[model samples]
Target: MRCRGLSTLAAVLLLAGGVPARAAGPLLVNGNGDPLVWGVNPIPFNPDRGTLGTLDNAAAVQAVLDDFGVWAAVPTANISFTNAGALPVDVTVANYLSYLGVCGDGLSPIIFDTDGSITDDAFGPGASNDILGFASPECGSFVPPQIAEGVAVLNGKWIDGVDSPSNPEIPLADFKGVFVHEFGHYVNLDHSQINLVEGFDDDPSNDDAVATMFPFLATGTSTPHLDDQVAVSTLYPAASFASGFGTITGTIFRADGVTPFQGAYVIARQVGDPRLTAVGYASGARYFPSNTGGPPAPALRGLYEIPGLPAGSYTVEIEPVSHFFTDGSSVGPLDPPAALPGLPEFYNGANEAGTNPPDDPTQSVSLVVTAGATLGGINVVINGFPPAADDCSAATVISTVPFTAGFDASAATSVASDPLQSCTFGGPNQNGHSAWFTFTAPADMTLRADTTGSGYDTVLTADTGSCGALTEIACNDDSSGLQSSLTFALGAGQTVVLEVASYNAGASDVLLFHLAPVLP
Candidate 1:
């Protein structure tokens, strides 16, 4: 798991698979739950003599200094750092751990491991394989915890690409990006999910929009996004910071309208230019076993506030955290993240209960934000409606050939299927968000069905007969990559049931199910 700086002063951030004991918010907090910040400005840091593989000592040191400049350059944030030159002695694998957690002694060191030895020593064996780097706060106080000092470590193997040639050797620019991000944590900033799209790291197109503190490093740039700027400004605001940006506050609720919903991503996107945005999780997001237990009262659990938004008309929406971004790569508060019970929707003042239509993005309403103002009561109650094709009884009908449609199984529930006895399409005990679709043959023909363009591993199955009593005709798995494909024969006027399911639980995104006639 990530080492997010939290409220407790002495709290330590353990690496992957370890329990995430600390809590997080827009800003890191102290023991008394006050926001944490450096009581002094121009924080001084000492660097070691080790090189980042190809980058010599001078180049590596300059990279760290330059990245610190990027954060100091934020016009609204009163944050600055100075390079205090080399450490008293080079901290290598021999005695690096001793230098860690040494706070209030006026030493904040940045150690560089030319190889994976130091990294493995600190985190464990094979840690350097995946972890880029990490930062931690060595607290000096607990009440209204103020950061006296901190420490950070960078693994050079990512840049050297020696251990694993297949591992993407980080570009110098992206390396600086990682420096800025780790420094963000060093200065007591937790991970923030803004302008988030699942699986965004592999696709560089979304690079410019990602936040510096986003859990995973996308196209790493030295520059911090608006979300990062606001977070820093919230802790170390300049005189003009407040007057320069506006705030939006609200509460998110379940269909019952009484129970608050936490862990939902709340985003405010500029109406005309969607590139400009800000995001936050609901108030109780950091609490484990979400929505019920937290330091905050039940009434305040789902409250969210987005600050540092420029004056403009903007639309707001809520979506579930991506299922892939859990555990070590977790986003927001809940580790092993939770998905929203309903579909992603906007704040249009309509909530789904029994009869109300499901909330839609197209129906979103815009609100005007002004400088130095806090707009409150912009509440939203998400629709409780499940996907239309969730059950066989509500199966969506397809009449023509070569048909393809998008389906989201994130909110779809598993149906009754004896996979071991009836079929092995998805293996025994496979999680079935099995969405249903129907097709009738115009004439007897062989048809091929496949989930070729799906985002996650899928299982495709064909069945004959009604929902209650059905026999599996054909099922396929891993026909191409992790996608599934199958072919079936049918007579004229015959109808077949198509069930699209996943091998992994809580899979979403467009399930591209393609069906076409096979000409012989």
Candidate 2:
């Protein structure tokens, strides 16, 4: 979340170079196989600057890999030593090996030790590598240390200072988000082309900005933007298991009768059985957007190509940058709101409002793909969902909500402010929306939802399957109570349903929903 300051400015001015030539294809290493994948075992600083929780942090990191289907094996090298006297050379080598599945070929997914030193090295030059986190000429761009075959050494200093679950400098909950970005690079993802035009310079522009593999460091606030997931999935498709893969293509439009919303994110996910096999996982399966191009130009109709998918059923969901405002008004550009509290001032232009949140209570559409078939014309019609006057006065409100595979409103333990809430949503009453949303699940998956809000008493639910003979996941009638998280198991070829129902019925409120791959 920190910038390079005058030093970076001087470097850019001195170079005066145009944007680097965009690679036409995947970055090649040694002209042989895919790019050499690597990993980091962040070294810790003496008297660690922040808190450390091994299990939760590891879970967070694993979640990132699981989402992208990145094949990361258990670490092979020994990286237990943490003394400052010992350089992080071994630690880096070991971590990279782990990512390569050197330790065990069939490892589901693993999270290595997030040493403090590694975290620092990721952000900037510390006792180890000189690369700066989220800055141009990053550590990975430099000559990576060489230790073993097919392994590259990663400096932890930059990452140490940047923030992670292993480091207490920032919120531990966000360690997975930052690691997701770094891991994207480990799998050969580069800075988004959009960052170049945004004048982000050497450092990342926004902490909470979306993009699974965004170039920025962790702010413990940002969620994976639509582009982020699409890129990753494009590189790896979940449906690759069946004989031949299928393709789903589509355009996104505003359901509110506005112009087509360019730069929006369209994600297609397999509905049933959130659990994905480890094999063929890292090859860019279930997740996309991050591994592809950067954010599209404003008003520019962008074409999305999702390839390398296994033939099966899928639900495609399109989410645009959505922001919330107190009064009903047009959502502004992606820039940070000029006026807001506890929010930074910067805009990346990815906003979704009006239609549905990732967890909206409604099932939009469905698609069935046969092996080797390229399905097209899967268009999305986004419906704007602004908050009601009474709903705006509620005690708890969420500005931006990340799209998770399984979202249970009753199980929502806490309500955090949407980091992307710019003035565009038009005050409290106005909010963002999603184009038509779709999700694919196994035929036998069970879905459920509930409504719980003090000021607002309604909840929306939707999906591809009918809610006939379904069980109630959870219920909280007390307005003062917090929302609970929902849990459901979906099977392949099954559809989930979403609909809206009022809990208290004092005032009608709107909820948004989108679909994403559920990590096993």
Candidate 3:
């Protein structure tokens, strides 16, 4: 069923699919250019015979159907949905696995984990806050071998349901929101951390967030938004898909005009509509070399293409990839800076803090995209100098309340070799530069230091006192992924020193830290 007469952008975006026929940007992720869909299968659910009304078979089934309807209503997509009733589970593997008939029947099942036993066990009991509901990808083109489908598990034990589909009205975990988020993955849609909380505490449960596909299920997940709609539509485009959208492609460069700049993020925001944001990365992966002919050395390069944008005027903005990207927002490969290579700037260096170039991307001289047309040559040159604001040595440790520091540089600003501890406080064996910091642990708590996604290989060190008589409390190479991590036991009210240095003279990278009460 196709929407032969799609109307306004709102009509096309919000109401299009909800009706019988219709239409679709943010980013239409890198799927193999193939139509990745789950077909119109009965979205089955196993209530686990729970007493909660929300978990009852009928209500649970309807909930899944309603949410599926919300997505199927998209007029421009060929994706369809139907209820498969409850999955037959007379006897099977583990309780959760039983609900997920991957072993018995080849179908995706949504499990309502009534007892904490299954959900907690799957996530390792104590470590579930970082998770709520999850979609299992059995197949697809995934980086961590993802963007596929297998099974979905919802922590029914914790979900306090809010009946209305138009909900998640508060910050509490809403059932509808979780289903929508998981379904997005069921359709091969990945997470978009576009709604990153302004500062170091990269929480994404923003009530005002625009995408249902955000990494952390935000309040906005109850309903689809511009970002979600465009991405889904692009993947499963319907009839007449090309008549309503266009594409924007370009390259990101350093001042030298020859070096490719990788990891920089790009977006085409619709003029006057702050919510209409289309994101793309100036990436070296799956793209060509820079315009000046030099490769994005040290694995740094930038090239982008944003497709499925409604024909309209848009401001193309370029900015530095904030450290929060690795803190939790960004998925797949780590994108932390190896060096604070440059400050964020607009395309063509317009409206630079000091310069008043009339053609700043944010102004009237914006890029105009025509339906089905590809707009190229929208190149941007990032300011190559590292700003002091981004330098670790130039930072002030505010409190021991837990924070983050990034060292996207070549060498440690300064380091020490302590004789007081078995291992010297010496950091990173690699020509890897470093960043410095200090914090006062207000109370007795465990300190967790990490370099999960710092671009280059990493080595982190923690000490107290002066450089001459340092206490090498913690030091590590690799514990998580290609990054480094360390869990330090510290008492409250103690002053602790921290270091973020790369392993083996690595490239610009990022680091993360956390503090919590020692678990009994």
Candidate 4:
């Protein structure tokens, strides 16, 4: 039977004021007493299982799960339909919770029905409790199921009518992809780990092809990307809960040849079977771009310190700020260096390094940070232009120039270039560029920028993207006009680009970009 009144809980909570402030401690998991769960059978027109609909059945679900190496027996239930028109939010929410293992009298499962009210279709307790549900009509809007606090809600309409002519069934693989994503939320996976992708490595330009949990929704081909598996296994390891693993500490700095980068994210992931990769706080942490917490290292001037790591070998990544341009104009206050020909109307020009494109790492080094030992000398350097001639005017000209051809990160003479262009930029001139780099994404990232030339109007900007259109994420154009920095999200395979240019034309020798990855 379709449940009523349950769908309104989410609205009531919103009306009563959203999530209450949470005090610091280990993040709470599945603490909610009233858990909601949802269920669906693929018989849209037929009320009996004999005429079961065309959508993927339990066998299909099991096959997809097997692809990810997760084995579970599908449960059978005699789900009765009351010709209730549509499922209710209460039922959807309850079902959603049950799928994630989040119901009971302290653990009893709470079931609700979707009465098909478009407005009241979806239900949830917001980011705090991590439980929610929605009707089939609403489910069409989101590809994957979502969760909060161990809840599993489904769109019964979509599930039943998955094979409808107007709305054909989504691929079984895609269905599994959605389930995996929603289950991620049940365990508190934040929208991709922002800091880890943005600020930790040298090149913040390349996209992470292996990140399963990247923010993009599934299209029915369910397969966990490397990052996705890393995230899930890390937060909810196979082993039972235990405490007191040793910690590892280290700093990530710019390469020896370039200026120190700040506010970049640094991440460390175990190298081995995807299922065994370390995650959460154990995967890696972040340090801010400004290094406000402390001083740079003696050898590496812009050093970042990361702490609390389980002992293991890890891949490291660094990225710039995570922002994108939308309207083809300026992103924040930073102006374009020069409008390129035939540019799009709305573009993102925040991350336009002469050499290093967003997601492109200037350096990559393998090191082991012991469970309790502090490691040092992990320096990443960007190539800088050599000194100009002695003439004062020449010096001014050289200093004011935004970038030197010699310093481009793509100019690396040592390594073979990947056929894929690393970074890109957006702004008035479509000249905005992107770079690609590979690194381990820790839990957080920081970004920082500096201006070396005498120009008074230089500014810094940044953006982020997974596989689709880039979005404006963050930017900083300090009124002082010399330096700026910020920290933001980083998804695996996600690219972050930074743009350094004059606020106004006529200013030259104006910009410098520095990235540093801090671990905690």
- RMSD for each of the candidates: 9.7, 17.6, 11.1, 16.9
State candidate 1's TM-score: 0.72
Residues 1-520 of candidate 2: C-alpha lDDT, one tens digit per residue: 3332111100000001112211111221211112222233322111111222343333433444353332222121112212122112233323533332232221212223244344243333342222222211111211121111111122222334554322223333444444444444333343332221111222234433323343333343235443343333443333432235566654445544234544343445555721120001111111112222323233233334454445566655543322211111111111211111111111111332234443232454456767777887555454443332121113122221123121122312211221121112122211222111234553343343333221234333333333223232222222224322244555766444333333322333233332222121
Give the runs in model 4 whose Cα sits over 4 Å from its true position: 1-149, 155-169, 191-209, 218-226, 238-315, 321-361, 368-520
CA lDDT of every candidate: 0.66, 0.30, 0.48, 0.29
Candidate 3, residues 39-71: lDDT per residue as tens digits?
334334332334222466566666777776777
Name the 10 consecutive residues with the lowest summed lDDT in model 2: 6-15
Name the best candidate (by lDDT).
Answer: 1
Clashing pairs in 1: 1-15, 1-16, 7-29
Per-candidate clash tally: 3, 148, 41, 142
- Candidate 1's residue-wise lDDT over 240-345, tens digit each? 7889778888887777777878767788888887764655554444333321212434444577778788999888877765543454446655654545655567
State the lDDT of candidate 4 residue by residue for 1-520, as single tens digits: 0111111112111101112111000111111211111223211210111111243334333432343233111111122111222212223333443322322212211122222222133332232111122111111101122121123232223334444433223343444544454333333332233223221233214223223233333232144443444334333333311121222333332333344443333344555631224332211122111222223234232343333445666545433322221111111111122111110111112322223443133334445545546555443333234222212112122111111121222221111211121122223322212222212233343433333322344344455543233344655545343544544455544445444433332233323343434221
> Which candidate, 1 or 4, would have the higher TM-score against the true structure?
1
Native-referenced Cα lDDT, model 4: 0.29
